[model samples]
Every structure is written in structure tokens, then in C-alpha cells.
Target chain A: MPSYKLIYFDLPGLAEPIRLLFSYGKVPFIDQRITKEEWVTLKPTTPFGHLPILEIDGVPYSHSRAIFRYVGSIVGLIGKDPMENLAIDSVLGAMLDIREAIVKLRFCEDEAKKPELKKALEERYQRTYKKLEVDAGKNGGYLALNRPTWTDVLFCYNYELLRNALGIDVLTPYPNLQKVKKTVLSQEGIREYLKKRAPNPMKPKYELQQDL
Target chain B: MPSYKLIYFDLPGLAEPIRLLFSYGKVPFIDQRITKEEWVTLKPTTPFGHLPILEIDGVPYSHSRAIFRYVGSIVGLIGKDPMENLAIDSVLGAMLDIREAIVKLRFCEDEAKKPELKKALEERYQRTYKKLEVDAGKNGGYLALNRPTWTDVLFCYNYELLRNALGIDVLTPYPNLQKVKKTVLSQEGIREYLKKRAPNPMKPKYELQQDL
Candidate 1:
């Protein structure tokens, strides 16, 4: 197996999925977390001036989604074929759209704009989740497949983020999505990782480990 | 071969890459262009309520990037290995970052904030292009490899957008990127497609066919 080293901040933001993938496969890696002060100096050295870089063997690679896909390939969590991958990528894209809206709301500096942003985000996610619920129901409690895939894991993280970060229970109205989270959490490797992983510094109250 | 149908607006915004891929491979697809009036009726019917949906043998798929990757795979423009895909995806991700900044700037409702957004976008693209220049130089004019991949085609479209939409000649500073554009435009299939494809409704002045 190739040596892997993942570098990011201490938070369980974008890098958490990569870490979960590594843990799911029981693959050994150096999970290097840096402080904001250190990131100021390290940012210049990174390929795209971003965190969550995975160094395979010795070469550094950026882009969180790219790294997630590569790691998913390594862990046998990715789709079996091109068509299957298309399914996975579609769901991933929808989740990302919601995440983008949440990020926009989180970073809005104007106090007067928060309610409108939050309202738009609610509408967006509700619509997306309605479609995702049907997909999960058809796939037998998974997002892109009958069996668990990396997208299910991604949904689990997103579920946590919506709850902890935004104080929203995004999965309650959809039983199938709830099932997707349960299926992902039941995986042995994931369960073990959740138990041992560090709490997200930003949102300490609702870690996945708490559920485990 | 499966019957492919690409549905999008008349503008060559997101769906152009998919169209270019099909045209490059000489694959037949229904290039369905809908007006804003048509979109109102079509939006709720779409899987994710978005334009640029691709129906593969009658099953519709949403998400532009997902469709792009699927078409790229069908046309044999994707990477041969996971590592190669990492390279392609890294460059694709960078280009997407720039695109996002451009979109944000374009949609800014506050005229007073446009200057700050524009300055930030300029700095962002310049820094990104410097890194991409070295990569293209190393790859012998392509963004990810020695041969043109789908990302090179994406760059060509982005190049046109930057030029005609934003009135910025993005490739002027980077000879290697200019070479990349030349290399993509020289492809027989791509050249044919450009020669016959309809002019971008949004940026009619700088249609890529002009370069051909």
C-alpha cells in the first residue's frame, strides 16, 4: 500500500470525509493538523493555498473533492462503473449545493442579511432533501446504491454539520435519509473511528462520536 | 451506443463542455436549448430543478460536473488511472474556483461592492494562472497531461468566457495557456464543432469559431 499523509486544520470540516475514508479502510496515515498561525506560513507552500492536502508517497495533491474521490477509490467505497459513478456524483453535487448555501450564510457579515440567507438555505435544502429521500428509499437506505457508499458517509458528515453548525435537524423529516445515516454509522471501521476521533473544535456539541 | 440528450439554455454557460465532448467524439445527442419561458415549465420537471440535464437512454441526470465527467469518460478524455485523474481534477478544481469567483462578481447586486470583488477576482485568477502555467508547460500545452483532456476543452470555454463576458484576455500573460487553447482549437473534431455550433447568445462577439 502507498503511504498517505493528510494535512488540514483541527476542525472536522472538509478533511473529515477523507479521514473517515482512511479509517473505513483501516489504512494508516499521518493526520497532520495545523493552527491558523501555522497555516499563514504553510499556505504559501501548498499547491492551491488550501488545506486538506493528501500526500501520496511524497507528492502533494489538493482539492478536497478530488482527494475524497481518490481516497474513496483506495478504500473500495467508490462506484463500480462510470454509470454508477454518475449516480454518486449527482447526489454529491446536490449536497455540495446545500453546503455552499450554508457557507454563504455562515460568512455573511451583514446582520440584516442573515434571516433572508437562512430562509433561502432552508428552502434549498428542503427541496434537495425531498429528492434525496426518494433516492435513499429506492436504494434501500443508501444515497447512491443499495449498499453503503462514500456518499452515505458524506451525508453523515453533512448531517452533523447541519445540526451542530447551523442548529438544524436536516434529516428528521426524511426517514430514508435517517436510515442512510444509521447505515453509515453502523460500519465497524467508521464506528471505531468516530469513537476515537477528535471533536470538531468549531462545533464541539454535536460530534458524530457522540452518536457512536 | 446509448441515446444522449443534453438540455440547457441557449447560452453556452455550463453545458458547453458536455456539447464539446460529444462533438469531439462524433457522438449524437439532442442539444435541447430552452428559453426562460420554457425553463419555467421545465424547471419543476427536472430531477434537481436545474438546467443542463443529460438524459442517458431516457433516464435524466442532473449536475453539470457529473454529466461532464460521464461524457468525458464516454469520449475517452478522462484519465487512465486514479493518479492521472487526480492531476486532471486538481486543474479542473482550480478552474472551477476561478469560475465561482467570476459568478459571484457577476451577480453582485451592490454596485459599490463590484470594485472590491473585481480586484479580488483579478488577484485570484492571476495567482492561479501562474501555477497553471507551470503545469501546462510541464504537460506540453495540456492542463493535465501531454495530450489534450476534457479539462483543456473546459479551459477553452473558460478562456472565451473570460474574454467575451468579462472583457479580459486571460491568456495574454501565459504563453503556455495560450498554447493550450491553440492545441484544443486545432483538434479536427473540435474545430468542426466550433465552426458549426451556434454563437454564444451572451457573448456573440467572441465565439470560439472566430479563432478557428
Candidate 2:
């Protein structure tokens, strides 16, 4: 296999899905976590000055979604057909929309505006989760298909972020989404990876390992 | 061949790239443009209540990027290898980032906040365009490859939006990006489609067809 090294912040923000993909496939990779200070010096050298860059065989590539899809392809976590992939990708896009809103709310400096942002985010997630819950239910506890795909793996990380980082049990209302989390965590490779993975420094109160 | 029907606003926002892909491949598809009034009734019927839904063989699919990639694959505009696709997808992701920022700036209701949002968008596009310029130069007037890909086609629409909707000649500083636009516009299928496509109702002042 080509040498793989994933570079990102220590947090399980965007890179966690990719890490899970590699671990699930039993593909060994160097998980290079960098500090903000180091990122300052290394920023200009990056393709888009973004984190969660995956270097494949010494060639670096950026964009977390792009990296996630690439790793997913390698790990056999992708769909069997174009339509199947499209179904998975659409869910991925929805998840990204939710993630972006959360990031915007988290980084907003205006304290008074936080409530509005939070409310907007809450509304968006509610609409999105309701739709996703239906999909998960129809797909037998998977996000896009009856079998677990990378999107389900991504949902697992997103679930962790919603609960631990945002301190909201967003999945409580969506039993199928909760089952998605369970189904993903139940994977032997994922369980093993979570058992050994480092606790997220940013949100230490609830680790994914505890759930596994 | 599967029957294709694309539903979106009359404006060439997210759906244009999918149209371009279908046009490039000489694929016949129903271009279903709906009014805001119609969308209000149709909203609840949609999977995610979003537009640019592509129905393949009567099966409706949402998410523009997902549809774009699916159409691109059919049109043979996708990269040849996994790594090559990664490169193209990275550029596409960057373009999405730019588009999202533009959308945010456009929708900002606060008069005082508009300037700040515009300035932030300006800084972001400048940084992003500079990086894209280098990629275009290396790829011989294409964003991610020596030959035009779906991203090059998307860039054509994005170029028009930057110039018309935003009223910014953002490509003037970047000769390579300008060349990329020229290269994409020169494609026979693209040229034909642009020549006959309806003028964007929102931005009638400048149309992509005028460039062709």
C-alpha cells in the first residue's frame, strides 16, 4: 500500500472520519497532529492553507471531504454504484451544511448574536435530522444504505461533536440515528481504534471510547 | 439511456454546472425551472427542500455537487485515477467555499454587517484565487489538470457570477484563471450551450453567452 499520512489538529473535528476510514480498513497511517503554532509556520505551504490534509505516497492533498472520499474509496466503504454514491454524497453534503453552521456559531465573537446563531443552527439540525432519521430508518440503521458506508462513519463523529462539543444530545429524538451511531461503533476495527485513540483535548468529558 | 430531469430556479446558480455537463455530453434532459411560488408548494415534497434536484429515470436526487459529480461521471469529465480525482475534488471544494462565502455576503440583511462580510469575502477570494492561479498555471490553463474537467466548466459559471452578480472583475489579476475561463468557453459543447441558454433573469446586465 502507498504510504499514508494524515495531518490535522489534535481534535477530532474534520479528520476523525478519515482516521476512522483508515482504521476500519486496517490500513496503517501516520496520524500527524500539529499545534496552532506549528500551523502558523506551515500554513503557506499548504494547498489551501487548511488542515486535515492527507499525504498519499508523499504527495499532499487538501480538503477534508475530498480526503474523506478518497480514504473511503481505499477502504471499500464507498457505494457500489453511481446512484448509490450519490445517495451517500447527498447525506454527506447535508452533514457538511450542519457542520458549517456549528463552526460558524462556535467561532462567532458576538455574545449577543450567539443566541440567534444557536437558534438558527438548532432549526437547521432539526429539519436535517428529521430527514436523515427517515433515511436511517429506511436503510436499516445506516445513513445511505442498509450496509454501513463512510457517511455512517462520518455521522458517528458528527454525533460525538453534537453531544460532547456542543453539549446537546441531538440524536435522542432520532432512534435510527442513534442506531447508526451504534452500528458504526460496533465495527470491530472502529471499536479497536476508539479503544486506543487519544481523548479529544478540547472535549474530554465524553470520549467516543466510552460509547464503544 | 436514463431519462433525466433537472429542477431548479431559472437562474444559473448551482444547476448550471449540471446543465453544462449534460450539454457537454449531448444528453437530453428536462430543464424544469420553477418559480418561488411553485417552490413553496413543492418544498415539503422535496427530500431536503432544496433545489437543483436531478431525477434520473424518474428517481429524484438532491444536492447540486452530488448531482454535478454524477453528471460529470456520465460526461467523462471526471479524473482518470483516484489521486487525480482527489486533486479535482480539492479544487471543487475550494470553489464551494468561495461560493458559500459569496452566498453569505449576498444574504446578509444587516446594512452595517454587509461591509464586514464583503471585506472578509474579498480577502478569502483573493487568497483562494491566488492559489488557484498557481494550479491553473501548472495545469496549462486548467484548474486541476492539463485538460478541462468539470471544475473548469463550473469555474466558467462561477466567473460569470463573480463578474455579474457580485460586480467584481476578480479574474483580472490572475492571467491563468482568465485563461482557464477562455479554455472552458472554447469547448464546442460549452460554446453551443452558452450561445443558446436563456439569460439569467437575476443578472440580465451581463450574461455568460455574451462572453462566448
Candidate 3:
């Protein structure tokens, strides 16, 4: 067995899909999670000062998408054709678009600015959800190449992350996305992986409703 | 020659490298650019409400980076090994990081936020430039596996975009980037391509001078 180690914060923000991929593919790996304080200290030493570094046989690789693709290739999930690969990539870009917008919301200081930001983001999410729904409809219920691939795994993780972190009912907005999430989550290996894993460490703050 | 038509707004932002790759490789393609006003009218009909769609014999492919990679593969740019391909992708991801930061700064409403954003961005740019410099050094100045490839063309276009749009003088901070940019720009076909192409239409406002 080839030795693999995934180094990241003790969170599921970016590395969860890779972990899920490894699990679904039955590839064993060491999951190394660092605390927030440790990230501050250890980040600069990592390639590109980022986490979610994958080490295979002691060689380090950076960039979450690239790492996901690498592991996905091993799991036979990355698409088989160039156009299929491109379709997978387009969906990933939308995921990043949502993530960047949410990051902006995370960094905003004033409460007054948040409503406006939230509205803007909600609008963006609605549009994105529509696109994903259309793609899902056309691509045989998967994002690309007519089968459950890495893009499906990615969509599941992203949808679940938004639910766990944003506190918003993402599925309420797009039933197709909700269905996609449920379908992927129900997959045999993925379900088994979820059964063994602990509660998500990256759960967002807003999931808890405030007591007025 | 395979028939292909690349559609984009009349700007050199994301579509130029693909254009340059096709040009440099002497591959025939339809360089279709629409006006910004036309984009405003037509975007509602587009699959993702964005331009730079490549039509291969009439079937449209969206996403700039994906199209670039597809064309790059045909033109012999994508590397052989997964590791090498990931390295190339990291550079592309870093370039997007810089572009997203720039885009955020462009739309920020509060003037007070501009200064900190610029400072934060310069720090990020320094990080990218440093790593890219070292990577280029290790690879003898090209950001590709062997000879100059589409990745180098993309990097060259990135440098030109920064110099022309942002006007931040990044080359001075990382001399190696400047050298790599110079090397790619001075290539025989690339130099000719630049000379013949019109100046890019969408110039950055550079409006936050007081904050700078």
C-alpha cells in the first residue's frame, strides 16, 4: 500500500472531498489536523502557506483542487474525456465562486454591511443553484460524463459544508442539489465513511439560532 | 485543421492566452470578440452568463481556464506526469488568486477598506511571486516540464495583465517573474502576436490612489 498523509487544519473546509475520495476508493491515509494556532505557525513552511497538503510516499503536493484531482484520478473519479474534465472544472469554479463570496461575508466587520452582503450572496447562490440544477438534469443526475464522479463527491461535500457552516437551507433553494447531496451521501462507501467519521469540525457559527 | 470558434467580450483578459496559444501553434481558430454592451444583452442567454466560450465545430465549451487547457493539450503544453501537471495548475490557481483579489478591490464601496485590501493583496502577491520565482529558477526559467509551453504563455499574459491593468510594478519586487515574463514575451511568435493584436479594452481604473 502506498503511504499517503493529508495535512490540514482539524476542519473539513477544503480537504473533506479528498478524504471522502480516499474513503470511497478504499485508499488508506493519515489525516493530520492542526489547531488554529498551529496553522499560524506551520502555514509559512507549507508549500504556498496553505493547508490540505497531500503527501504520497513523502513527496508534498499543494493546491486543494489539484490534490483532489490527483486523488480522484487514483479513485477512478476524474472524468475520462477532455470535455468531461472541463465540465467537472466549470462546476468546481462555481464552488469557488460561492466560497469566495462567503469568505467576504466572514471578513466583513459591521453588522449593517452584512444584510446587503447576504442579499448579494443569496442572489448569487440562487443563480448558482439554478445552473447546477440544469447541469444535473442534463448530465444524467451528475455534474459531468453521465455518472457519479469526483464532481459528484465535490458537490456533496460543498452542499453539506454550506448546510453545516452557513446555517442556511441550501437544499430548500434547489431541490435538485438537495437530491444530488442525498444521492451521493447514500452511496455505499460514502455512507460507510460517514458512519465512521466524527462530527464535522468546520461547522459554521450561524447554524445555532440566537435566543432573543 | 479542426474548426473551432472562441467567443469572448472584446477584452484580452481571460481569452488572450488561448488566442495566443492557437496563434503561436499556428492552429486555425475563429477569434470572435463581442462588445461589452453586446455581452450585457447576450449574457442572459449564455449557459453561465459569461463569455469566452469555445465552439468546436458548433458545440460550445465554456470556462476560460478549461478551454485553455484543452487547447494547450492539443498544442503540447500540459505536462506528462500528474505531479508536473499539478505544479502547472498551482501557478494557474495563484494567478486566479491575484485576479480575484483585484476584482474584489474594484467593487469595494468603502474607501477605508481599499488601503488594507491593497496591502493584504501585495502581501499575497509577494507570496505568489516568491514561490513562482523559485519554481522558475528550479526549472531554468520556464514554468513547464520541458520547453516553453502554454503554461508559459498564460504566465506571460498574467504578467502583461498586471503591468498593464494593475500598474503596480510587480516585476521589480520579483525580478525572476520579470525575467520569465520577458522570456515568454520575447519568443518569436509571441512577440509577433502581441504586435499584431489590438490593445486590451478593459483597463483597470487604478482609482484608489489616495488609499495607496
Candidate 4:
């Protein structure tokens, strides 16, 4: 098997899910984190001058979603069927939508404008969570198929990030989301990975050691 | 096989590549378009409240990239090898980066600011084109391996849109990009599809209708 080396920011911003997938699937990988200053030098070396890059063997691949999909496929997190994959896409894409909203808000300079942005995000988040709740309820435990696919890794990572780091109390609106989190965290390999990589902040919203 | 109906803006926008793939692969599909005002009314029904939805036997698939990948797989545009697919992802992801830069400039409301936005976009476009030129030269005509994949469709579409609609000279800085465009447009099915699809004002920055 080709060695997968994931490069990203120190925070779990985008690399966490891939890390979780590696751990969950019992795959070995190099989780390389660089400082912002180092990224300034590293960016130019990247294919698209971006981070969260996955290098298989020595070849590099950029784009978080694309990398996620590739990793998901390797770990059997992608479903066997197309429809199941589409269901995964729906939730994953919605999460991307949520991330885009967060990116938009992150660029806001005014402290006073933050509350409005937060409120807007909360509204969007609740609506997304409600849909996820319905989907999770329908699926038994997983997001799409009964099996835990990459969508689950992504969803679980997102939930953990939001709840642990963001302190948003967002998942409280969706019981199924909370349940999914518990289910993923309870996995033996993932539990051990967490213990081994203790105190790693899995979301950008959280500072080091605070969420842990 | 499931019947697929792709719905999007009346103009090409994000849905064209899927249409192109379906046409090239000779897959039967319902080509559905909605007017701007119609989109206002219809958007609410869409997942994430957006258009460019692919209804696979009445089940809706939103998010352009996911739909493109699904269709790419069906059409054999997604390479046969895993590494080739990863390379394709690199190219496509890079194309998306360029497209997003163009999108950022597009959202600028101040007309006076457009020139500055355009200038930044031009520099970025030239840089992206240069990188792609190198990749294309290194990997034969296609971005991934030697065969034309969805990366070609993505690049051709973006190249045309960047050249025509965006009114930027993408070719001047990167000669190899123009060559890749020439190679893709020569494909029998792709050539026919472009002819029948009407003049995509969305076509790349440099392509003429006859070239399609």
C-alpha cells in the first residue's frame, strides 16, 4: 500500500476527518502540521498553493473534499451502491455549505457584526441539522447506508468540532446527530486514536487543549 | 439504468459539463433548464435551496462536483487507475480554485473595483494557466494520464468561460492550455455536443463557435 501523508494546519480545520478515517480504518499515515509562517513558504510548493494536501507515495493531491473522497474510498467509507453514495454526497455537500457560511463569517472584521453572522449561521445550522436528523432516523444509525461511510466520518468530525470547539450548542437541536457522535466515538480504534493523539483540537474554532 | 434529469440555469453555468458528459457517453437524459425568475420560485424545492440538480430516476442530486463525479464515472471520464484519478482531482481542484477566484471578482458590487478584481484575476488566471500548461505538457494532452477525462471537460468549459464571458486572455500566457482546448474539442462526440448546445456565452475566454 502507498503511504498517505496528510499535510495541514496545526488545528484540525480540514485534516481531522482524514485523520479520523485513518484511525477508524486502522490505516497508517503521517499527520504533518505546519505553522502559518511555514505555510507561507509551503503554499507555493503545493499544486494549487493550498493546504490539507494528501501525498500518496510521493505524489501530491490538493483540495480537501477531493482528498476526503479518495481517502473515504480507500477506507470503504464510500458505500457500495451509487444511491448510498448520493445520500452521502447530500449530507457532505450540505456540510460544505455550512463550512462556506463559516468562511464568509470568518472574514468579517467588525465585532458588532459577528452576532448577526452567528445568528445567521445558527439558523442555517439548525435547518441542516433537522434534515440530518430525519436522514439519520431513517438510516438506523449511519448517515446514508447502515454501514459507516466517509459521510459518517465527515459528519462525526463536524459535530465534534461544532460541539467541542465552537461551543455552539448546535447539535442539541438534532438528537440523531448527537447519537451518531456517540456511536463514532465509541469505536475501539477511534477511541484508542483519540487517546494516543490526546488534546488535538479538531476544529478551528477551538484553541489548543481547551476543548479537551 | 436509472433515468436522469439534470436541471439548472438556462445558461450553461455548472450544469454544462454533466450535459457534455451525457452527450459524449450517449447516455439518455432530460436536459432541463429554468429561467432566473423561475429559479426564484423553484430554488426553494431544491436541496440546500439551489439549482443544478440531477434527478436520478426522480431522486434529486445537488452540488455540482458530486454530480459531475457521478456522471464522470458513468461516462468513463474518471480514469481507470486510482493514481490517474488522483491526478485528475489535482487538475480539477486547481480549476475550481481559478473558478472561485473568478467568482470572487464576479461578486464585487462596486464597478470601480472591478478593474482591480479583474487585474488580480488575470494574474491568478495566468499563473493557473502556466501551471496547467506544464502539467498538460508533462502528461500528454490530458491532465490525468493520456486519455481525456472529466478534467478536460472542466478545463475546456472553464477555459471558454474565462476567455469569452470573463473577457480575459487566458491563452496568451499559457500556450499549452490552448493546445489542450484544441485536443478536447476534436473529440467526435464533444465536437457534436458543442455544436448542438448553442453558443455558450459561458464558453471559455478564447474559443470561437466553429472551434467547438
Candidate 5:
């Protein structure tokens, strides 16, 4: 197997799912986190000048979603075939719609205009979450194919980010997704990793550590 | 095999790549183009209330990128293994970064800020195009691999959309991508589909018919 090294900030932000996948599969890797100052110097070295890069045997692959899918595949979190992957990838893509909404709101500088952005974010989040809820229910608490796929990892990570960022308990209404969180956290590898993982300074409100 | 039906607007927009892939694969699909008036009634029934949906045996799957990947797989544009798919998917994802920049500028309705957005768009386009040029050169004129894949399909489609939308001929500077476009367009299936396809009203400046 090729040596895997993940480069990102100390915070979970984008790299967490990759790390979580490594742990979930018991794959050994170097989880290298750089400071913001270090990121400036290293950014140019990346293929697309972005963080959350996965370097395999010194070959770097950027684009978080692409990296997630790649890592998810290696860790066996991806589906067995194209059709199965489409189901997983489609759910992953749909969650991006929700993530995009939160990201749009994150860029708002005007304090007075935040309410409108938040409301729009809430509406989008709820609608997308409701769709995922139905899928999760169909899959028996898993996000896709009635098993734990990378979609579950992505969903849980994005859930906290979107929830804490939006300052709302959005998942309270969705029982199936909550079950997804439980299913993911129940993994032995993930549980051990989370217990030892450091608390996130950026999102002190909720981190993977909280699940442990 | 399941019967494939693509539902989208009368315009190409997000649905073009799906159509192009089907053409490339030589698969027959019901190209269901509904007008804006019809979309309202159809919207409520869609999974995410969006167009560019692929209904397989009447089971609807929305989200354009997800649909593209699913359709791409059926057409044999997807990679045979996880690693190869990663390369194809990463290239597609990188192209999306460029596509997003162009789309953002396109949606800027402020005439006063148009120049700034245009400049930023050009810079982004040039930088990303240069990177893709390098990849194309390495992969023997194909974006992801030496031979044609779904990455080529996505790049060519996004290239035209970004080009006509920005009113700029971005491909003239990159020989490799030009080769990529030619390779995709030269496929007998894609060529025949383009010839028979109607002109896009939204982008009156350019259409697939122009290449044909």
C-alpha cells in the first residue's frame, strides 16, 4: 500500500472526513496539520492551492470532494459498483447544496443582512435535510445502500459545521440522520480516534470529540 | 438495462453534459425538455425541485453533477477502477472550480462592478486553463488520461458555457484543450447528436451546432 499523508489545518474543517475514513478503515497515515501562517507558504505547492490535500506517496490530490471520494473508495466506504456509487455520490452532491447555502452565509460581512441570509440558509438546510432523512430512513439509518458509506461521514461532518455555523439544532427533526450519527460513531476505529482527538478551537460548540 | 429519461429545460444548460454523454455512449434516452411554464408544475414532484433530472425506470434522481456521473458511467466514460476514477473525478472537480468562478461573474447583475468581475474571471480562467493544459499535455491531449473519459466531456461542455457566457474565446490560447474538444466532438455518436440538436436560445452566441 502507498503511504498516505493528509495535510490540513488543525481544525477538522475539510480534512476530518478523510482522517475519519482512515481511522474507520484502520489505515495508517500521517495526519499533518499546519498553522495559517504555514498554510500561506505551502498553499502554492498544492495542485489547486487549497487545503485538505491528500498526498499518496508524495503525489498530492486537491479538491476536497474528489479527495473524499478517493479516500472513501480506498477505505471501502464507497459503493461496490457504479450504480451504488451514484446513490452515494448523489446524496453527497445534494448535501453540497446545503453546504453551499451555509458557505454563502459565512461570507456575509454586513450584520444587518445576516438575518436574511440565515433564513435562506435555514430553508435550504431543512429541505435538503428532509430529503436525506427520507433516504436515510430507506437505508435503515445509513445514508446510502443500507450500509455505512462515505456519505455518512460527509453528512455527519457537514452536519456539525452547518449546525454550529447556523446556530440551530437542525437535526432534531430528523431521526434517521441522528441514527446515522450513531452508526458512524459506533465504529470502533472512529470511536478510538475521536476519544483521542483534540478539541476544535474554531468550533468549540461541537466537534467530533463531542460524539465520543 | 433500465430506460433512461432526462428531464430538463428546453435550453441545454445543466442538462447538456448528460445529453452529450448519452450521445458519446450511443444510448437512447427520452430527451424530455419542458418549458419554464411546465417546470412550475413539475418542480414540486422533483426530488430537489430542480431540473436536469435522470429518471431511471421512472425513479427520479436530481442534482446535475450526480446525474452526469451516473449517465457517464452507463456510457463507459467513467474509469474502470477506483484510482482511475479518482483522476477523472479530480479533473472534473478542478474544472468545477473554474466553472464556479465563471458562473459567479455571470450572475453579477451590477454593471458598475462588471469590469472587476470580468478581470477576476479572466485571471481565474487563464490560471485554471493553464493547469488543465499541463494535464492535457501529460495525458496525450485528454484531460484525465491519454484516452477519452468523462473528464473530457465535462471540460468541453464547461468550456463552451463559460466561453459564450463570458463572451470570450478562452480555448484559443490552449492547444491541448482544443485537441480535447476535437477528440470529444469527433466521436461518431456525439457528432451525430450535435448535428441533430437544436440551437440553444439562452446562449445565442454559441451552440454545439457551431462545432458541427
Candidate 6:
């Protein structure tokens, strides 16, 4: 196995799904968390000055979607065939879309437009969650393929941020997605990782620890 | 070979890359372009009420990225291995990021924020284009690999919109991306498609036909 080191800020923002994947695969990796001060010094040396750069055996790779797919493929969580991977990727793309919207809402400097953005975000999240609910219902509570894929982990992590950013338990209305969360958390390695994971100061209310 | 039908607006928008892929592979596909009047009645039948749905055989697949990857894979445009795929996907993700930023800029309702958004988008495009330039320079004029991948086609289509939306020829600064555009344009099937493809009303200034 290649040595792995994930460089990111302490929060579970874009890097958590990757960490979750490693844990689920029962693989050992160096989880290198950085501070904002350290990142200021480190940013110039990065390929794109972005976080969640996964160093696979020392070479750094950027972008969470690429990194997630890479790690997911290694852990047998991606998909076996192109068609299957297509379905998996579609769900991942949707989850990322939601994550991006929530990020935008959180960082909106325009106080006047914040409410409008928030309402738009809430509606988007509801539509997305509703669709996922049907998929989860059909796939035995997994996000794709009638079993757990990286998207399940992605959904669970993004749920944390979406819940905090929206100031609502975003998954409450969708029982199927809630079940999907339960299925993901029930995995032995993920459960162990969740139990031992460090507390994130940024999103305190909706911690994975709470799920554990 | 699977029979393909792409459903989207008459404008290039999201469906053009899929069309380019089919054209590049020398495959025939039904290009179902709809107007806004028809879309209202058709939207309810769509899986996610979104366009650019790829119907393979008869099953409709939603989401552009998913559709792109699936079509790319079938046409031998996706990378062969996990690491190779990481490279391809990184470029694809970057292109998507740029496209999303441009979309936001185009739809900005706040007049005061328009220039700020425009400047930021220009900077992002430059950064992305510079990175792609180096990669294309290294890979003998292709965006992701030495040979053409879906990203090369995606880059070409996005360059059209990004150029038109920003009201500037963005590729002039980066010769390798210009070369990348030339490489995509030189494909015989793509040349034919570009020659016959309808001009987009939204981006009337820039068209792929100019490349042909």
C-alpha cells in the first residue's frame, strides 16, 4: 500500500470524506491537520493553494472530487463498472453541489442578500434531499448501488455542514437519508474512526461524535 | 454500440460537450434540442427537472458530469488507471469550477457586484488556464493527457462560453490552451459537427464554428 498523508485545516470541510474512506478501508494514513497561520506559509508551495491535498506516497494531488474518486477506487467503494460509477458520481456531484451552496451561504458578506440566499439554499437542499430520499429508499438506505459508496460518506459529512449552516437539522424531513446515515455510521471501521476522531471547533453542534 | 439521445436546450450550454464527444468518437446520436415553451411541459418528466439528460437505450441519466464521464469512458477518453484518472478528473474538476464561476458572473443580479465578480472570474480563468497551459505544454497540446480526453473537448466548449461571457478571447494569453483548442478542432468528426451545429443565441459572439 502507498503511504498517504492528507493536508488540510482542522475542520471536516472537504477532507472528511477522504479521511472517512481511509478509515473504512482499514488503512493507516498520516492525518496532517494545519492551522490558518501554517497554511499562510504553506499556500505558496501548493500546486493550487487549496486544502485537502492528498499526498499519495509523497506526490500531492489536488481537488476533493479527484481525491475522493481516487481513494474510493482504492478502497473498493467507487464502482466496478462505468455505468455503476456513473450513478455513484452523479450522487457525489449532487452532494458537492449542496456543499458548495452551503459554503457560499456561510461566507456571504452581503447582509441584505443573506436571507434570500438562505431561502434559496434551503429549497435546493430540500429538493436534493428529496431526490436522495428516493434513491436511498430504493438502494436499501445507501446513497448508490444498493450498498455503501463514497457518496454515503460524502452525504453524511456534508449533512454536518448543511445542518450547521442552515441552522436546521437538515436530514430530519428525510427518514430515508437518516437511515442512510445510520447505515454509513454502522460500518465497523467508520464507527471506530468516529469514536476516536478529534472534536472540530468550527462545527461544534453537528459533530460526527454525536452520531457515534 | 449503445444508441444515444441527448436532451437539452438548443444552446450549447451543458449538452455541447456530450455532442462533441459523440462527434469525436464518430458515433451518431439524437440531439434533442428543446425551446423554453417545450421545456415547461417536459421538465416534469425529467429525473431532476434538469436538461442535458443522456438516454442510453431508453434509461435517462441525469447530471452533466456523470454523463460526461460515462460517455468519455465508453469512447476511450477516460484515463486507464486510478492515478491516470486522478489527473484527468483533476482537470475536469478545474474546468467545472471555472464554468460554475462564469455562470455566477453571468447571472449576477447585483449591479455593484458585477465588476468584482468579473475581475475575480478573470483571475480564476487565468490561474486555471495557466495550469492547463503547463499541462498541455507537457502533454503535447492536450489538456489532461498527451492524447485528447473529455477535458480537452470540455475545455474547448467552456472556452467558448467563458470567452463570450467575459467578452474577451481568454485563450490568447495561453498558447498551449490555444494549441489545445486547435487539437480539439482538428478532429474530423468534431469539425463536421461544428460546421453543422446551430449557433447559440445566448453566446452569439463566440461560436465553435469559428474554430472549424
Instruction: Report the number of the highest-DockQ candidate.
Output: 1
- Which segments of model 3 are wrong by more than 4 Å? A164-169, A172-179, A202-212, B105-109, B164-169, B172-179, B202-212
In angstroms, the error of model 6 at A77 is 0.5
DockQ of each: 0.75, 0.66, 0.44, 0.48, 0.70, 0.65
By TM-score rank, best first, the candidates go 1, 5, 6, 2, 4, 3
The weakest ten consecutive residues by lDDT in model 6 chain A span A200-209
Task: Provide backbone clash counts, one per model.
Answer: 0, 0, 1, 11, 0, 0
Model 2 misplaced regions, further than 4 Å: A110-116, A165-168, B111-116, B165-168
- Model 3 chain A poorest ten-residue lDDT run: A203-212
lDDT of 1 by residue, B20-115 (tens): 989888899999998999999988887888778999999999999888888888888888878888888878788788888788898999999999
2 or 5, which is superior by lDDT?
2
Worst 10 residues of 6 chain B by lDDT: B197-206
TM-score of the first chain in candidate 5 relative to the native first chain = 0.93
Runs of candidate 6 with Cα error greater than 4 angstroms are none
Q: Global lDDT of each model?
A: 0.85, 0.85, 0.72, 0.75, 0.83, 0.85
Q: Candidate 1 chain B: minimum summed lDDT over ten consecutive residues — where?
A: B199-208
User: What is the clash tally of candidate 5?
Assistant: 0
- Which candidate, 5 or 6, would have the higher TM-score against the true structure? 5
Q: Return the TM-score for candidate 1, rounded to 2 decimals.
A: 0.96
Per-residue lDDT over B115-203 for candidate 3, one digit per residue giving the tens place of the 0 to 100 score? 88777767777787788888777777776454565777787666655554456666776666666777766666666676677655554
Q: What lDDT is obtained when candidate 1 is compared to the true structure?
A: 0.85
- Better model by lDDT, 2 or 4? 2
- Taking chain A of model 2 alone, its TM-score versus the true chain A equals 0.94
RMSD to true structure for each model, in Å:
1.6, 2.2, 5.1, 3.0, 1.7, 2.1
Off by over 4 Å in 1: none
